[model samples]
Target: MKLLLLTAGSRGDVEPFAALARRAAASGHEVRLALPDRSGVDTTGIDARSLEADFSALIESQGVSPLAAMRSLRDVVRPVMRAVIVNAAQAALEFRPDVIAWHPKVLSAPLIADALGIPHVLVELVPVMTATREFPAAGTVTRSVGPLNRLTYRAAAGAGAMFRREVDEAAEVMGAPRSRRSSAPAATLLPISPAILPRPADWPESAVLTGAWRAREATTDAAAPTPDPALDAFLAAGPFAYAGFGSMAAGDPAARGRALVAAARARGIRLLVATGLGGIAVPDDARGDDVFVTRSVDHGVVLPRAVAAVHHGGIGTVQAATAAGTVSIVVPFIADQPFWGAMLHRRGLAPAPIPRRRVTADRLAEALAAAPAFQTAVEAAAARMADEDGAAEALGVLERLAGRPRNDALRHP
Candidate 1:
């Protein structure tokens, strides 16, 4: 099968597709991935291409009010997102994939697939699309609003509708009229562990809650040198707290780093701080032997050895911490982050969420002191996720779709 995978956003949004691509390729299927041009994504063994826009540049700093964030997303992010979707549509035409799987950000995929009469799957990092009474949409409210929970999904629908004109333009360029773009995706795959958040009964059967996708590390030649000796040494020294805010422009990273360092010092624990996408910065005065700062680290490699993981509550980081069986200390900044943090806390997997605005050295130290209490719940959740292979399950869906009669007319003559 020739599969085309498309996604847009930060590393968190792109990595899952990359993992799925690696798995599909390993299973002897041809795969192509289209995503934003960004560092920190592992595209080693898969065929990949860059979309036109660099979506990372549009990421707003944390602490913006919800209304302000929505306005900025409309004025700043939407244009870039539209461009990316168009680029993905063009890639689909060129690749003529037998099956398509795309992040929700790429609204053009469904139109393209409908026009070509091929199967397309929607890949959600969170439960934004499917309406459920169990909880409100991820970024809307941290708590459920009873029977009104189902109505919150209109926000996601409106978000996609905002790009309707652009999506139609892109599809029209590929000989797909607006009328032919009505078919729904073959499946909606949420690469989240059911253990952390059980599937709601209201979801359609087409929606599958596959566990978090973890990409395999590329095999390096024997002569290859170690990537980061300092990080390796830090892990070897003793158990430490892992702190990183991947791709979130946490406001005033330097100050945030200082607070984290102070908190670690207060608790008398070692700290491994990763300044991912400038979400956290290590101040000059705070650098010490007990504190190791790096641009990035493999969560799979480092988190398992750590005593706890501290992050901005991105679903990717949440799942990583869960899979590693490391208790979390979520310092949510914006959007769905707080929701994930609250969910973890409610499940007894972590201390109560500490919003970034409320984060202080004393508060962080308290959370760190309390982290050990959640270890049992964290380990039990990890055990539930241990046997899951989300990437493989997603690939199976694509394979089954590819077995159907293909639209040979859309292929090259």
Candidate 2:
């Protein structure tokens, strides 16, 4: 079976699909990853395809300001949706995949799958539109809007409808009858464990809860030795806290960086800060001796050595920290982050979420100090997640959808 997997966004969003692609290939299926041109495809073992005129420019645009990008996405939802549809159509025409596996945000894949008369599987990293009262809204705050959270529900449904329409258009373009579009069967794969997000009542039967498919290897470069001897000394001292806002550092980054530095110092712990897309400047006082600041480093390598992990609570970051068996201090800013933070805390795997608005040196210090107690809980959760065969399970589902006859060779051997 030939599988076309589509994903977009930061490294976190693209990496999981890449991992899935690798697993599918290892399982004897031909897998290709279709991603935005700017996503920095490694293209070593898998077939990598790009869908942009200038990938670097696209990434640079997104990296300018995390908050701004989020706001822009909210404001121009239609245009963004259209761009996704166009990209997916182009990829589908050329690739002619037997099945389409797409990230939830890449709404166009389902439509293309319908047009091509193939199965479409939506991969959700977070429980955003998955219909659970588990966490807060993925967007900015809002006042109560009445029963069933109709406002939020409508927003979610509208987004779903928009994608549905795109899929219908793609079907027409691919010469499928209109009636088929209305009845097209869609399936979803939640790339998170049920332990993190319980199966919500509102979710349809088509959706399956699969544990996160994380790569066994770290994709980012290793942290280089700090130039300052004091910083080097700190690294040698003991396991310290790893802190950063994954990609939400653009809004007041200097202030946020300073606050993180102060919090780490207040707790008397050494820190390694990832600058993310928007670079976080290390405070002059915190820079020279004790702290190390880098643009990026593989969380898989660093999280295990850390006593605690403080982050913005993106799904990928949370999974990485949890898999490493490190306690978490989630400071969620926007999107599904708050939901992830709340879920981790409710599971007793991390301290309570510290919303970006409420994050301070004192608050962060307290969370860091409390993190050690959560270690036992984190290890248990990690063990449970490790037991799930996500990549294998996803492949099994994909093979069945492509109408391929299942045999022992596909599963094992």
**Candidate number with greatest lDDT:** 1
Q: Clashing residue pairs, candidate 2?
A: 111-167, 231-289
Among these predictions, the greatest TM-score belongs to 1
Q: TM-score of every model?
A: 0.92, 0.82
Model 1 clash pairs?
Answer: none
Give the per-residue lDDT digits (tens) of candidate 2, residues 24-101: 888788888877655544558779876443323443455444455556654444455555666767778888888888
| Angstrom error at residue 170, model 2 | 4.8
lDDT of 1: 0.83
Task: Give the RMSD in angstroms, all C-alphas superposed, for model 2.
Answer: 6.0
In order, candidate lDDTs are 0.83, 0.69
lDDT of 2 at 107: 58
